[model samples]
Target: MSADTPYREELAHALRVVHAASVLTKSVLRSLKNSVSAETKADDSPVTIADFAAQALIISALHAVYPADAFLGEESADQLRKNEGLAERVWQLVQQAQFSDVQQRENAHARLVFPATKEEMLDVIDRGTNAQLKGRVWVMDPVDGTATFMTGNQYAVCLCLLVDGVQQVTAIGCPNLRVNPQNPVNVKVHEELVDESGFGVILSAIRGEGTSVRTMLSDGLGEPCKIEVRSSTGGKEIKDLDLIESALGSTSLSQAEHKAVAEEVGAKWPGTVIWSQQMKYIALTLGATDVMLRLPLDKARYTHVWDHAGGQLLFQEVGGIIQDIDGGSIDFSHGRRILGDNNYGMIATQPGVFEKVNEAVKAVLARRT
Candidate 1:
């Protein structure tokens, strides 16, 4: 065990977690969004069997690896299951919502996510809310790219470990992500030169250590190269550099807000935003693009900690950085979630280039304040 020995160990663990998650995600995404039915969660957002399966796999792994760690996840059956008495508890949490006392479980079958059975439902919910949350707990979003997963496009299985509250590590498995789950940082080129459908990308990062990239086809970890944030003077720092964002297809991001950032920064702004949930950060880390800005669609409901944890570290793991619009840090400690999850927008940029982007964002915030 040398200087990088510990890092290598962590890298391996993070890779393992993401790979497990990717296995789950790929299974779900294979059907695309066609097979599963989407239902609104307590949050009034869509959730599917893919989401349930992905989270279940990650939780199962965490329970096996470190049982005592606290766990916080987005989708849980605990509140919706009857035998577990979750429905009654949730009814209270939501201020007296109602559920049916009618025939249950087996009958609801085909249309619902896995574990539609009463006993299975209880297990899912129990696993979900079972957080004692003392030390090194894991945070997960089984299928972070719900829309993409639903559509059979791109999504991710994200898992991160937090000691006490600080994020220590993050593992992202984009089965459809198109990159190797192996060491992506130095894996060379993309599997498909053109970012088309049917490929997966893997990006992993640990706090303090840099980020790495790999394609799905590559194996055994190639020479891991260190990537830097877009440079300030060279190909990286040309002031108004190439901007990459989602296909403008997902409603999660609003074009009106993005256009404003480009206007303020005077950026050239061009490139396709890789659709994979966690792959967005991988793209930025590898120098595919400069920044990824996400403004909250709903002001009252903030972003989830699980939502950004993997992406945040990937940039930091590489030569990039992510900051709230206020230039303050994003809070993962808040077992509670980001405010309005949408109120605080995101800014992802190469190290030096970020300062400029931040300057532009501040101008917008100052005016709003």
Candidate 2:
């Protein structure tokens, strides 16, 4: 490795850990046998056992190789710490996950030990609870869409490397995501472009390096081909643009506002409503959808960092632009939340259409105030 490319080695190590964790998550999902169970978190969101296991698997593996790297994730061990039975269940799940035969037999690092005791497991799970924001932190969302995961629909195992709060690399594992749009897993969108076939795609990108996509079933080590945003017309023409929006409603985002902006821009008005921001970003990169808009229902709420960290960088690296509705860049340095005072959510599109969409959003928002 060259001295100038310090991130090269770390990026490889990160990819390995993320790939292994993706395998673990897929295995855990399979073990569910199609019946999903979830426990509500303090914030009223759903969390499944697979979430905890995936977080522990990835964090522990990376910690072994990069002990100096910090860890931050979505699931915490607080609930498990308060309930021994839950802790035992999660521990058993983690134990059942093992490196694949190829990994164990061919890779020397596979010999590294995993957390053996209940205490160790809980400690590893609690790693995400750390409040530190600065430095080289490994941010992850063990499972991005618990609801979609439960339905055996769309979800993602998202992770990224942020140095001093700026994203440097992003990797996402979409176990059920269709690589080729011709054979879409279950497209809710209006139009179909090209035809392609494959299931489960893994996307990764470094800051300067362009984005690449591969099949996740290959353990994320498959031959990766480069990808870019379809076009950069900036929503210049209504009929030519494809759009996506949030299907699941949240207090922070307004569907009416989304509709208004779509109309303002002469867009089809009723764009595809997709689940999970991570997957929506993937669709944009794959050219499934040309633009994605996320707006808050109100001003008090902020988009969580985990939701956008991986997908945001992935889009930017692929020649797409992502920013707040105000045309400002997203700020990820503010601890766990996006370091911003506004609740505009995010608007993403190729370079040319970004300004057009922003202006339409401004016009729509201006009418409300």
Candidate 3:
């Protein structure tokens, strides 16, 4: 179909699908997200049961709904074979009849053998690693923030419907993290949580149209709450040109040739350090923050599509912009959604000011070397 197709109905449905799966993720994440214990992947990044369960939930649910649609997720064949004495542990978990929460189910993920062997699980997770993205492909990051999720912070069930590399529909399920992370009731539906104040946030955007937020639910998603960019007048307002950045995630930017760019130009405003994931974009698009920067330790080293796709759509639809250090849009065309493909070190801001932002960044880069 063409860009922003009228015939494209799958995006909205997919949004609901992820929200359904997010319910499992939220419950499971809440239980295990607080676990300080973790495992490091070959890439030296932290991964936990939350990531595995989230992937399993998404893949299983997607297959049930649309068995024909191809899927691509992060955990793959390499992971299944790494640990020893893990097979029996997996079988024990899988053989159990009921799952109390997502964590329990995930702890037993090795048991839920699809074809045979743990590598099959990884293959399922890697279904989209090198996906033929030119047609209708479903891109997913079962858990967008592995580290954040491990710390009981922010993370997401990040998924989007990309037709020919253009994002048509975007869905981000930040179950525990707030739309206003500080205020859970920003727009979450009070179905399962039972607390009116603990509303879950769902940010959705239809390309070329606009973005909105509402209660995340399985039965029916509530009405859309329209969003727009609020200006940071260079005064003392937190909402002005200030940004939401993490000292850890910003490591690469600090070592970059232009390390002092943001704090130098934008007056280094106060920020709340929520874990990174789709929620950061939700916060940015929903007026929680004006600018959001991802200055990784190695600007060129670590980056992924699952991290930015949902946020990019939300910010763009809500009148903001996201791009690389050089100001070009991040590419999601690589079906596998790997690093070194598109924009890594990213800067997101309002649409009109990106030109100025780009210049400021370039100026800083030039001064360094």
TM-score of each: 0.73, 0.89, 0.75
Q: Pick the candidate with the highest TM-score.
A: 2
Clashes of 3: 10
List clashing residue pairs in candidate 2.
Answer: 182-196, 234-352, 234-353, 252-296, 252-297, 253-297
Reference-based TM-score, model 3? 0.75
Off by over 4 Å in 2: 1-4, 99-103, 110-113, 180-199, 218-220, 229-236, 248-251, 339-344
- The per-model lDDT (C-alpha) reads 0.57, 0.73, 0.58
What candidate 3 gets wrong by more than 4 Å, as runs, is 1-8, 81-123, 179-199, 217-221, 228-240, 248-250, 255-259, 269-272, 294-302, 335-344
- Model 2: number of backbone collisions: 6
Stretches of candidate 1 above 4 Å error? 1-13, 31-36, 78-125, 130-134, 180-199, 215-240, 246-255, 268-271, 274-277, 296-301, 340-343, 366-369
Q: Which lDDT tens digits does candidate 2 get at residues 1-369?
A: 246765776667666666766667666656675457888999999998889888887788778878888888998998888888877887887776654524654666554346778789889878887667689888999888887777666788888888888888788888766554233322443222211233366788888787777765543466777774444544346556678866645435687888788778777755665677787887777656777877765656676788888788877876788878766788777778763474357888866777878888888888876
Give the alpha carbon lDDT tens digit for every residue of 1-369 in model 1. 246644455556566545544644454444444344576777777776556545554555455555566677778773355223434332232221001101222354211123333454336435756343346667777777676567665566777777766667776766654443343332322213333444355566677766655554322233344455434424544445656666665656556567666778776554455555465765666555667777654466466677776677777765577777656677666564666443366787766777777777666555542
- Regarding TM-score, does 1 or 2 come out ahead? 2
Q: Which window of 10 residues has the lowest lDDT sum in candidate 3?
A: 188-197
> Judged by lDDT against the true structure, how good is candidate 1?
0.57
